[model samples]
Target: MITERKIDLTGLKCPMPIVQLAKLIKELDAGEEFTATADDPAFCLDVESWCNKTGHELIRLEDSNERLVAVIRKKISEVE
Candidate 1:
């Protein structure tokens, strides 16, 4: 079964949200998903770029209330 984790990054500044996201992604198994909520205005763009650069999938991104919410799926492990 696929697992989904939730992370709250509200009030965090630029980079911190992405930093926390990266840390959480590292701990997730391949194909697992995470939903992160942040108040940083840059989070929307940052997460998109991060996913593109890292091969992860940005499944959904939206603004709710005063927060930016993103759902990301962990990338499959690369063969060595």
Candidate 2:
């Protein structure tokens, strides 16, 4: 079974949300997924780009009313 850790950044801006995600994701083990909620539209692309650059997996990007939900998987290894 897989468990998800949810982080809400509803009122946060672009870099802050992504920056917070970077720190939070570092605390999670590999294979674990994190769901980040934000109201900043830029976060969708920013988060995706950040994950791509860092080699973490982007599982999903969805919109729920006023919030954008980004699901990211922590990389299994840091050897990249």
Worst 10 residues of 1 by lDDT: 71-80
Name the candidate that leads on TM-score: 1
RMSD of 1: 1.6
lDDT of each: 0.88, 0.86
Candidate 2 regions exceeding 4 Å error are none
Per-candidate TM-scores read 0.89, 0.88
Q: Which structure among the candidates has the greatest lDDT?
A: 1
Clashing pairs in 1: none
lDDT of each residue in 1-80, candidate 2, tens digit only: 67769999888875799889888987899989988889998887888899889899999999777679888889898974
